[model samples]
Target: MLKIQNLHKSYSTPQGPLPVLQGIDLNVARGSSLALMGESGSGKSTLLHLIAGLDQADSGSIQVAGQDLGQLSESQLAGWRRSGIGLIFQQFNLISSLSVADNLAFQARLAGRHDRHWQAELTQRLGLTQLLERYPEQLSGGQQQRVALGRALAARPALVLADEPTGSLDEASSNEVLQLLLELLDEQATTLLMVTHSPRVAARLQRRVTLSNGRLAPADGL
Candidate 1:
């Protein structure tokens, strides 16, 4: 569902251009999950941003469902993102004033594909039915992250990009969150590309690839 070919991105600095992603070639299959592992400053998040249309690559192509991201105008990209991509960051990013129910329904409403039935099911499956009336600040980190996932998936986006999704939780919470994510992704046949530093986290995905020096490489067993 997603493809990247020789993609390159760099940032301007006092010391000249700081190359981040160099020749990043990757392809993610439909209904599959991939773990992107790398050390700090390895450009994993940069690659995800490019694919999500939040940032443009300096060179090469990032194609999602046959559409080249680089070619889209900012307005077009905004629409594209609303329709096709679901993003979950390390931070919950939930609206502080919105209750869980509103937070979960936010994305679907924006995409104009709000389905009460689907959102209901997601809330139940994510074990968030009771918390619908609560706010983000009232929940634990894992609970908040589950709410974030619910918000993202509520739109039924074809692809999900998660950057260090479980980075803020404890081990048990991380495992629970990851398990729920896999189960939901399987049920919906959604594609996932998550950036994480934990081997335990990466090992659960269908495949893992390590990013190094702005390039992709097959990672040996964790």
Candidate 2:
């Protein structure tokens, strides 16, 4: 579902240009999940942002679901991201004023693929049945994360990009959330590219890759 070739990115600093990703190449098959592991400043998140069309790469290409992201204009990319991709962040970026149910259905509605049946199923499966009427501030971190997950998957997006999704939860909660996420993704046949710092987390995915010094490498021997 995702392909990258010769991808490069850099940022301007007072000192000079600082390279984040250098000539990165990666390919992820549809319905497959891959873990991206790296140290801080290794460009894991940068790659994710580029793929999501949140940021432009300095050079090279990113293709998701056969669409070349670099070719799309800003408006086209925004529309594509709304319908084609699901994003989960560590911060649980839910609307403070929206209730759990509203938050869950937000993305699906925006994507114009909202199905009441599917949303209800997701609510039940994610254990958010009773929390529907409550706002995000009323829930605990794990509960909020579940809501975020539900929101992302409620749209049945073709590709899911998660950035340290479980980073804010306790160990037990993290494990539970990750397992649930993997199970749902598998059921939906969605492709996943997750960035995580934990080795244990990376080991759970079908494939793993690591970034080091702005370069991509297999995690096999890391």
Candidate 3:
């Protein structure tokens, strides 16, 4: 469902061009999950951003669900991102002004795929029924993360891209949230590409790849 080839990216620093990703190639099948592992500054997050079309690569190609992302115009990319991809980040990124219910339904509504029944089910599954009226500042980190997960999945997008999703949670909370995420993804048959540093967390996915020095390799030795 996702493919990347010879991907290269760099950033302009005061000194020179700082390379982030170097000739990276990857393929993830439909309905499968892949974990991306790496150390700090290893380009894991950069790769995810490139795949999500939030940033452009200096070279190479990214194709998702048969559409070449490089070919899409800015407006088209925005529309595709709204309807075809669900993204969860390390930070909650919830709208502090909106209530939990509104945050959860925000993406789905934007995608024009809002389903009252489905959202209601997500609320219950995420243990958010009672917190619907609460705002982000009023919720705990774990609770806020759950709300973010609910928002991402409420739209039932074809692909889910998560970057350090459990980074801010404790071990127990992380395990709980990861399990729930996998269960929900399975039910929806959505493909997953998650960037995480924890081996324990990566082990839960169908496959794992490690990024080192901006290159991809099997996670076995990682």
Candidate 4:
């Protein structure tokens, strides 16, 4: 569902250009999960941002779900960001003012893909049925992460992009959330591309790749 070839991205700095991703090449099959591992400042997040259409690549092609992201206009990319991909961040970026129910439905509603029945099932399966009316602050870290997961998958997006999803959680909570996420993905037909630094987390995925020195280290980059 995703293909990257010779992808390159750089940033403007006082020290001229600082390259983040250099000649990255990756391919992910549909309905499969991949773990992106790298050290701090290894450009893992930079590559993800490019794939998410939140940032543009300096040179290279990124084709996702058969659409060339580089060829998309800003408005088209914005629309794609809304419907084509599901994003789960480490911080769980839930709307502070919205209830759990509203937060789960927010992106799905915006994408015109909201399904009440599906959400009903999701909440039950996610153990979020009793917390529908609760606000973000009312929930624990695990609960909030579950809500974030639900919100991301509610739309049945073509691809799920998660950046350090379990980074903030304790090991046990992270394991629980990761297992829940994998089970949900198994039940659905979407693809997952997750960025995680933990080997335990990476091992749970179908495939793993690591970035080193602005490039995919061939040893583990697959």
Candidate 5:
């Protein structure tokens, strides 16, 4: 559902342009799960941003679900993002003022595709039913993450881009969240590309790709 060709992204440093991604090529088929593994500053998150159209690449092309992201205007990209891509961030990114239920349905409502039945199912599956009335600060880290996941999947997005989804949780919480994430994706047939530092998490995916110096390595056994 996603393809990147010779993608290059660089930042202008005081000295010169510092490259974060160099000639990166990747393809993720529909309804597949893939893990991107890399160390700190390895551009894993940057790659995710590029794929999600949150940031523009300096060169090359990104095609997601048959749409060339490079060809879309900013307004078009924003609309596509709301309708096409589901994003989960390490920070949870929940609005403090919004209740859990509101936050969960926020994006789906914005996309004008809110499905009450789907949202109800997601709430129960993600263990968020009881906390729907609570705000983000009222829940624990794991609970907040569950709400975030529920929000992302509420609209039945074609692709999900998660960056360090479990990085902020404890061991037990991480395991629980990861399992739920996989089960939810499987049940919905959602395509996922996750950037994670955990080998155990990466191993659960259909494929594991490592990034070193902004280039992708072959999918090897974790």
Candidate 6:
């Protein structure tokens, strides 16, 4: 559902122009899951940002669900992202003042595709039924993460972009959350592109790709 061709991104550091992503070429099939694995500062998050339209690439073409992101204006991109992409960040990024229910429905409402039944089911499945009226601070880390996951998936987006989703959790909680996410994705048939540093997490995905020195490293089996 997503394709990147000759992608390049760089920044002007004191040392000179430093490349964060160099000629990254990737293709993610529809309804499939891909794990983006790399070290610190290896451009995993940068690439995700570009894919989500949060940041523009210095060069190259990015196509998600047959739409070329490079061609969209800023406002167009914003609308496209809101309607087409579900983003899950390492930090929950929940609104401090909003209740869990409101947070879950925020993006779906913004996209004008909020489905009451589906949202209720999501809340129930994420174990958030009774906690709907609570604020972010009132929930545990795992619960907050589940709420974040719900918020992202509530829109039924074509593509899901997750960056270090389990980065802040302990091993047990991370494993639980990852398994839950995978199961949810399978049930929803959602296409996922997740950036994670853990080998176990990557192994759970259908395919894995790593970034090295601003470029895609050779796939383990390909």
TM-scores for every predicted model:
0.98, 0.98, 0.98, 0.97, 0.98, 0.97
Q: Among all windows of ten consecutive residues in candidate 5, which has the lowest summed lDDT?
A: 213-222
Best candidate according to TM-score:
2
Each candidate: RMSD: 1.2, 1.0, 1.1, 1.1, 1.1, 1.0
lDDT of 2: 0.95
lDDT of each: 0.93, 0.95, 0.95, 0.93, 0.93, 0.92
Candidate 6 residue 128 C-alpha distance from true site, Å: 0.5
lDDT tens readout by residue for model 5, 1-222: 888999999999999999999999998899999999988999999999999888999999999888999999999999999999899988999999999999999999999999999999999999888888999999999999999999999999999999999999999999999999989998889999999999888888999999999899965953
How does candidate 1 fare on TM-score? 0.98
In model 6, the clashing pairs are none
RMSD of 3: 1.1
Error of 3 at 208 (Å): 0.7
lDDT of 1 by residue, 1-222 (tens): 998899989999999999998898899999999999999999999888889999888899999999998888999999988889899999989999999999999999999999999999999989999999999999999999999999999998899999999999999999999999998889889999999999999999999999998788988752
Worst 10 residues of 4 by lDDT: 213-222
Total backbone collisions, model 5: 0
Across 1-222, the per-residue lDDT of candidate 4 in tens digits comes to 999999989999998999888899999999999999989999989899999999999999999989999999999999999999999999999999999999999889989999999999989988999999999999999999999999999998989999999999999999999999999987887899999999899999989988998888633544
In model 5, which regions exceed 4 Å deviation?
219-222
Write model 2 residue lDDT over 1-222, tens digit each, in one string: 899999999999999999999899999999999999989888898899999999999999999888999999999999998999999999999999999999999999999999999999999999999999999999999999999999999999989999999999999999999999999999999999999999899999999998999988899963
Q: Candidate 4, which segments miss by more than 4 Å at Cα?
A: 218-222
- The positional error of residue 175 in candidate 4, measured at the CA in angstroms, is 1.1
For all candidates, the clash counts are: 0, 0, 0, 0, 0, 0
Model 1, C-alpha of 181: deviation from truth (Å): 0.7
